[model samples]
Target: MDLIACHDCDLLYHQPSIAEGRKLRCPRCGAVLLQHRHDCVERCLMLVLAALILFTVANAYPLLSLDLQGREQDTLLITGVIELYRQNQAGLAVLVLCVSILLPLIKLLSQLYVLLPLYFGWRGWRLPVAMRIVDILHPWAMMEVYMLGILVAIVKLASLASIVPDAALYAFAALIMVMAATDASLEPHDIWERLSKTR
Candidate 1:
């Protein structure tokens, strides 16, 4: 038996073995204390793999191309960060670099590291540390916010230049959706249970 505390009401309850797809709720506040997701590790692994591919594509290709005055320029995802740094906005550049690129990449890779080993029935040293890193970096991954800012900039620049959306733009959009799905399918409680059994 496992003792679980309700995040909402702080009531502690003994967690029972629940059937797959079922949830244990807190008696006082009715907050879900534990949930059993069927094949959560497998599902999350696949989603993380897809997200990795999308992340690669998003960074490799040009996000959009600008055609202004018969001159065309293609902008990669890192262009803005580089430009910001060049303009002496080092702090903002570092912030964007970490939140939009580095943090998300690290989070995805950490998820992969944790899920892949668990899926293969192997125990890795410091697996919990990897999961902890993922949890910490979760809020710092702000690709969606960056994408929204891109959209706003595109809308504003549409009159000044002919903006053509490119492969990276689509890849970035897909990445956001896939990352969201990965987060939803990932059950931390299930992961913790699996980790506890590892040698």
Candidate 2:
């Protein structure tokens, strides 16, 4: 029997061999401890690809357009950061840039670096280390939080100006859902075991 520690209750229990597409719960707290997602790598990779395309659209096109008294203004993801800096909110600009842009990009790139080679059965350099680093950076990828903030801002700005939803806004919304699914589908323990065998 494999010993597993419950993250919620900190109770150690003998982990049972769970089949694919099944979940293992902690006996003491009844908390879901492990989920074996079959074909986790393939599913995660597909979601990541969708996210990447959406991410590009989210950055390339205007997020929202503002029409105020015959004047028009549009903003993309990076444009917001620049606007903040231009308005002398340097700290806020940095925060948005890091959480919304930099960290998420790093997470996606690293996942691709690790997963692509593994999927194709090719040996890649430093894949294990890259995967570890990606895990560390995951928490910092606050795309969902940033999306929530944007929604709130849109609500607040609606009364001030005519807020027009753009293609990027829809793309960003889809990206959030895809990213969430990717997180749910990815089984880190299984990934590590598979990676070790390939070495």
Candidate 3:
């Protein structure tokens, strides 16, 4: 087993298996040691599916609707990103889209692809190292950050009009919940162990 010492604090963590990826984490500072997720792969997979459903609602439905001056306006999360791009903040728009929308989707899909088959006793063991890439991407996906931003925007907009939260907003919040649960539950080593055993 490979061991990694935490850079922030003096603690050591074991690599999930082979020296394939970076150390999964540093237990002391909660930094990335390597890319493996949590060990409860099956549980996390279910959460991923739930998150995907929430993600659909988050993107497809209007996030908020406002009525002011006898007019009503509604905006979806992606619409806000598009508006940002039109305002010449393409980088910021892309960042929002990727972090809030794309990353969550990728995480859900990646987790699903690996977990569903394994639960069904399929060829989960045969999947190559691409799952490692999913692990690598997990840390960067910040749905909470986006959620905070959304809350701030909602608060700011409230004083200006009759702001009514939409289905997507609720869905996004649920998505955040599910994603967090999945992140907490899915562990790479456990999945690998199960997969390896099946082989």
lDDT per residue (tens digit) for residues 1-199 in model 1: 7788889988877877889899888889997777898699999999999999999999999999999999999999999999999999999999999999999999999999999899999978799999999999988999999999999999999999999999999999999999999988888999998999885
| Candidate 2 C-alpha error for residue 112, in Å | 1.3
Q: Runs in model 3 with CA error above 4 Å?
A: 1-39, 124-128
Model 1: weakest 10-residue lDDT segment is 9-18
- Cα deviation at 46, candidate 2, in Å, is 0.5
Per-residue CA lDDT of model 2 for 1-199, tens digit only, reads: 7788999999987888998888898888888888887687888888888889999999899999999887999878888789899999999999999999988888988888888987888888988998997889978989888889899999998988999999999998998888888877878877887798889
lDDT of each: 0.94, 0.87, 0.75
Per-residue lDDT of 1-199 in model 3, one digit per residue for the tens?
8666765786876755634333456656787644543436656767887888888888889988889877999988888789899999999999988887787677677777778877777866435454775777787788788789878987887888888899998998888888877766666556776767666
**Angstrom error at residue 141, model 2:** 1.2
lDDT of 3: 0.75
Query: Can you rank all candidates by lDDT, best first?
Result: 1, 2, 3
Instruction: Please give the lDDT score at residue 133 for candidate 3.
Output: 57
TM for every model, in the order presented, reads 0.97, 0.92, 0.77
Candidate 1 vs candidate 3: which has greater lDDT?
Answer: 1
Clashing pairs in 1: none
TM-score of 3: 0.77
State in Å the error of residue 182, model 1: 0.7
